[model samples]
Target: MSATFAGPITRSPHPASSASDRIHRLDIRDLDELSPDTTESHGEEGLTMRNQKEIRETSIRSARKLNIRELRALLGRCGMSVSDYDIEYVAALHGADGQPAYGASPHDGCGRPLPGNRGRPLILLSDLALADLETAVVTIYHEIAHHRSYRSVGHAGTEAAAERYGWRMYSEFVRQSA
Candidate 1:
């Protein structure tokens, strides 16, 4: 989806609710208009230093739009054949029923089955779940784990597995690139 914006790029780091997900084109001219909680966290005073650090480090990459080629390299690091799947960024995703939702997946990622792709080994990332970089990485791994788990452990289990697995992949990528 094509959009025009000025200034530092950003969107809410939270999930999109149904009521606010209808806009096809967003006018993003200012960070103040998008994030009211930019300067402070909800309450970081009591958390451990590591926990606080993790929160800060794990923030969505709002300052820059993440590169898709970089993410494809991430998929390659995770062992998915880059050319086999059709991966692209989207502004908002459609519902499961395929209705138009302009910005429904700001903080979510999805993995979908492509049985007709001439023989894919497993499910791949839901092309829709990638509203941002953090969302893309997490969702890609989550979907990979989710589909590979054979529907036994469910979403939460898949999420846990994805964090563990995706972290290793990301860490390895950083190490190798360095």
Candidate 2:
């Protein structure tokens, strides 16, 4: 089946701000700090995939318990901003009339430009309590990338862009964290 990454709802630029200015800004310094050093070893030499997965799962569980500020900091280090948005952790996402789904970005519903901050875009996350830390983290970045791509390229190319950008950023996060 084809995978669809949801895009963000577009909003009109505020009188005092332009669309370019509102686009999510990636912090280079944060990224720099998150980059893994090639000289360092994360003890991957003898671990099997299952062992590595267990370690990652443990890390994710610990991360979920982190406070909002800490969570934001982690995301920030991955070059994502949760500053202007409200994040909702849900059991699972449902389509219109509540159909089962994995995740979605509410802003991606239409191409119409919304009023400046008209509504809090739902960064809908599903099964956070059960998802692997890597999956949860990457999903968040993936959604934010959708917002960024929607702003930059509009709806037509959002999914592809989000996938490209999200995976790249997530990879960097994993490397640096490792």
lDDT of 2 by residue, 14-59 (tens): 1222223222563442233333333321122110000111123443
lDDT of each: 0.33, 0.42
The lDDT, on a scale of 0 to 1, for candidate 1 is 0.33
Candidate 2: which stretches are off by over 4 Å? 1-70, 77-81, 95-99, 108-120, 128-130, 156-158
Residue 104 displacement in candidate 1 (angstroms)? 12
**Candidate 2: residue 32 Cα off by (Å):** 26
lDDT of 2: 0.42
How would you encode candidate 1's per-residue C-alpha lDDT over 24-135 as one tens digit per residue? 2222221112232223221211100000111233443345655567778765664443444344445534332333222211111222233323454232333333436555
- Model 1 error, position 163 (Å): 2.3
Best by TM-score: 2
Per-residue lDDT, model 1, residue 119, is 52
